[model samples]
Target: MLWRATDRRSANPLRTGLRWLLSLAFGYAGYRHLATPAPFLAITPPWVPEPALVVAATGIAEICGAIGLLVPATRTIAGGALALYALCVWPANFYHAFAHVTVGSTTLGWGYHAPRLAAQPLIVWWALWASGAVDWPFRTKARDG
Candidate 1:
């Protein structure tokens, strides 16, 4: 089981709002991936054995994770899963940065890629925080039993 805050009673407005916003973003991105996978395929690492299948699977997972986040019953599981998913797919981000891959006309450079690479942890934290999987500032360390 993934780490989660013990205090489920406390639900902050800001966190909830951010979570919803992210969900919308993910949902849209997922839809785009399903509708037009060419851009995603462009970012796929050359080493990947089957880029098309991977892209489709990742897109489906993202959509599911986004949907899971909205439901209170499955929020924690969804959060943990999404965090793991982000970690798993980070290689693509790294490849994009290192290779300076371009989708259509715009090429991704250090300015865009560096921050994206650096913000991965932040993305994981955001997923956890927004899903109420891990509370911070208000609560950091998990409660000791």
Candidate 2:
């Protein structure tokens, strides 16, 4: 099989730890987005419509996804959703990087942006892996018939 479902009984400690870490990270970020939207609003791409509403909605999504990750019934869907969320927000990262969008008076240099941009894919993969949506590079080959 190309992908293996995660078994809670055999769950990897590293993966579980990372999953909890991601949940905390996303949850906190969601709270920040809701409580103080100015930074997010500042980074929003100019072409996006209703930036404020979009920011608010994304915050809710992050919070929901974070919560979903903690529930076994919702983990897979949460992983997929969070992965897609990371992909969806990529453009904003780009805009921030290329346009030099400043959050408050702090203008982030490429040093910060480079790693973040590169890490985006890792984040998506992390969500998928952590939530058991996919198991790759670690899945064993099936026995021959």
Candidate 3:
């Protein structure tokens, strides 16, 4: 088997495979944004003053987090990185929350930003929990007898 039969949450190859798939999804999305940093950059405040460095660092962090999530040895680090990334990008989320954009002529409502903002903490929590950073709720019994 490609994966170990450890804790129930991570038991068997199927579950592990699913995890890798999810990680890949996040990684790819992050990569796309990294490849074209303009869309995200335009939203930042002019006084923030350092868009290039911010974009580069965030992109690298996302890419690294994605890579780390795939390997078991690096999962914990990945979780930490992801959690931090979520916190870092929060300002953009807030900007989107308050700013209004008109598409052609229709003014869309502000509900969309909720999900994006909520996603940060959710991803952070999931990454930490899924990576086994803490003792799982249903750990397998240790066979000492």
Q: What TM-score do all the candidates reach, one by one? A: 0.87, 0.91, 0.71
Off by over 4 Å in 2: 1-5, 142-145
Lowest-lDDT window of 10 residues in candidate 1? Answer: 1-10
Query: What stretches of model 1 exceed 4 Å from their correct place?
Result: 1-10, 140-145
1-145 per-residue lDDT for model 1 (tens digits): 2333423522677877888987887788788889999988999999998999989988899999999888887888888898898898899999888888899898977888889899999888888888887767456456533
lDDT by residue for model 2 over 63-121, one digit each (tens)?
A: 99999988877888899999999999999999999999989999999999999999999
TM value for model 3: 0.71
Ranking by TM-score: 2, 1, 3
Error of 3 at 107 (Å): 7.6
TM-score of 1: 0.87
For model 3, how does the per-residue alpha-carbon lDDT over 1-145 read when each residue is reduced to its tens digit? 3223224445436546745765776687678668887766765555566887787677777778878877776776676777777787878767746665433454346577778777877676666665555434434568311
Per-prediction count of colliding residue pairs? 0, 0, 0
State the displacement of the C-alpha of residue 2, model 2, in Å, after optimal TM-score superposition.
Answer: 13
lDDT of 3: 0.65
User: Cα deviation in Å at residue 20, candidate 3?
Assistant: 2.2
